[model samples]
Target: MDENGKIDTRTAKGQATRDRLLAEALRLFAIKGFEAVGTRELAAAAGTNIASIAFHFGGKEGLYGEVVRHVAATLASLYQNAFAAAQAESRAKGEEPIRRAHRVIAKLIAALAASNRSRWMSLLLQREFITPTACFDTLYEEAIRPCLEEFSQLVEATAGLAAESLDNRVLAYSLFTMASAFSRNGNFLRFTGKTGYAPQDIDAIGRAVAGFIDKGLRPSA
Candidate 1:
């Protein structure tokens, strides 16, 4: 790895091998977890030699860390455009933070739902959150904390509260958890008699989530 923490393989073939290792590691880790997976299994799964892991990632632990980074980058890429648009819209003149926040929350929920194709990614995250390892800090810093901070700031702005208030943070987490619950489970689709998260279904769910958050965030007279 280099100063930026990226694999520093110089060859295209080496980079391809490294990429394959990370992909296979994520799949296996999401299923068997870190403890159960071994170097041999990872190498065989990636169709590379065991030494390749050491060369590219240092070892299993290093590979796992890279896997977390891979997941973090992948998920961030998925929502970057939508989140960027919301951020820009919120900065517009006469824009209402509360309403924009609601829309952001809705888009987030829908994005998560659309991302269900990578169930393994969420399962891996669930495991990390439940039983963290040495790489938990990397995962938190790279993925979870940024999201929480973004939501917290949005919540503070939406509610016209002092920055970093406990209430704002808690509400932001609650909203994220609510959306995450729907994304992590298949029960939502089963209950709704839907086989897949089609575009129309995602849109309706997003609208509903936006309405719910909007209602909940408003102050009573």
Candidate 2:
């Protein structure tokens, strides 16, 4: 163990290098947009040699894939944990399953808001959607599809709707829309004289979102 009483210096250094690359990559991607940035530029921005990307990630495309995968993995873990916690909470309170599902969605929004990296991921995802690339399929499979399936299941089980129910799909899409609006349109909202929500506003947004979805999913009068 090193002086820090943890892993040795070599392992720590390796992790630091990887984190430096990710941080630089994220900054460049957010500022210049992904398609516009090149490998050498990214290396220079990260204060490393061009060969580092090749060594660390196999090349530019591989690095991009890694960046996307990193974010996707984080989000998947967040959602899974949030859902599990919501389920536990529901069981503890003896609440209806549907209410538990709503609670899960709220937890998800709160999780997203709590992580700046997640917010960056959301922005990067929106950019990817707007400009389809080879990485689109990778992101969709790794991140989007799983989340969609989970949300669908939560809605179906909670609302007692069929797997193929149009209403379930609509509800899932609406939730996605709501989440994306904050993520994708946040800057636009600020520009257009609307509220400039910070990371702390995530819970409030989540509450509002849960309320909206609950009202929509209610049985028709």
Candidate 3:
């Protein structure tokens, strides 16, 4: 950017600066929240000047908004891709709808678990839930709502209820909570006297969660 703080992110160097700022901003904002993280700290963390934050994102508030947008986009992509792949696999194998839902939940849990920044992302989301800002709408509309709607459709198919029905919506939300718990397992770890989970432990957790959900959704013989 020039002295006037006019950002040109189309260029390689400009884009790199913007990316670094966003990366560092996400970490800081997730850990310390938007109000607590100052412009100087953000710039120092990103190895850029304060002017770059203003040029690239307008200001600290603007940068926090962009960080939320970035997080929303990332989560939306993960949810969509996991759901699509699981649905496609189910169709190819002619699996039942309940089983398909189970597969989707399992894949989503695994994907979230495998994300390097899942804990940070979860912390950010918890903040949003506890204290919503204008950006929370962006996250809900872009990521959370879409995923809930799609998962509700899956729940409807398995449970033979309308997707918009209260029961179906509750079921969908509950299933999602179960799947996403792996990403926010700090409380669980502390309670269980465990430092962390291995890959196999995550896999086992996924299977156990899916089994309970599947049993709950199964129709009486």
Candidate 4:
């Protein structure tokens, strides 16, 4: 079509526009909180029209849900990949399942630390926990509960414990709590002089958490 004859794809441009909109919307939601943002404001922030939001995502609430789901799905995929890679590595090295679980946990923490969206998800999750919203059910059913269940099974199997045992459930909750706390409040704790761990100190904290949970889950002597 031109002197150089370079083809321009409409699909690619559309995808780019959608991604840009999502990115801007997420940033605004993170800064202003979801309830504080309106469709017109989101559209302007995204450098698009209000109609674009409705066309691309149905409506404002739909856009918000999609954003949340996008971030959740990304985090879930990262965790799943980390778990699989850890398992493969452990098998190659002939490491015990318990050690593999610890390695997986460490990998998860490192992955979370490296992800900006994961950090935002953690903040959003903490907010949800404190002030439950209608979206809470969707998030719980779609993301949180499934992750907890999978993690519970993994922890129980790694520990050589019965899955339905009280100790196993308690250990699962403790590990989940520790992980969520580390992601949500680790920076705040360091800022307040309560804990000195730096943002990049995931390995040390991971090891400590693994040891603490391991001991807590061990069968009574």
Best by lDDT: 3
Taken over the whole model, the C-alpha lDDT of each candidate is 0.77, 0.75, 0.85, 0.72
Across residues 1-221, which tens digit of lDDT does each residue of candidate 3 receive? 76898876568788888899999999899888888999999999999899998898888889999989889998889899988998899999999998888888788778887855766676687689788988999988998898989889888888887887898889989887777777774787788788988898778877888888888887556
Q: Give a tens-digit lDDT track for model 2, residues 84-152.
A: 898899999999877876797788776665656766777777778788677788777877777777778
Error of 4 at 141 (Å): 3.5
TM-score quality measure for candidate 2:
0.82
**Residue 177 of model 1, lDDT score:** 74
Rate residue 115 of model 1 by lDDT.
55
Sort the candidates on TM-score, descending order.
Answer: 3, 2, 1, 4
Residues 76-179 of candidate 1 have per-residue lDDT tens digits of: 66546556777787777467777777667777777766653456676687789899988788777777777777777777766655557888778888876765
Off by over 4 Å in 4: 1-8, 131-134, 158-161, 185-200
The estimated TM-scores of all candidates read 0.80, 0.82, 0.89, 0.78
By TM-score, how accurate is candidate 1? 0.80
Candidate 3 regions exceeding 4 Å error are 1-10
* Pairs that collide, model 2: none
The order by descending lDDT is: 3, 1, 2, 4
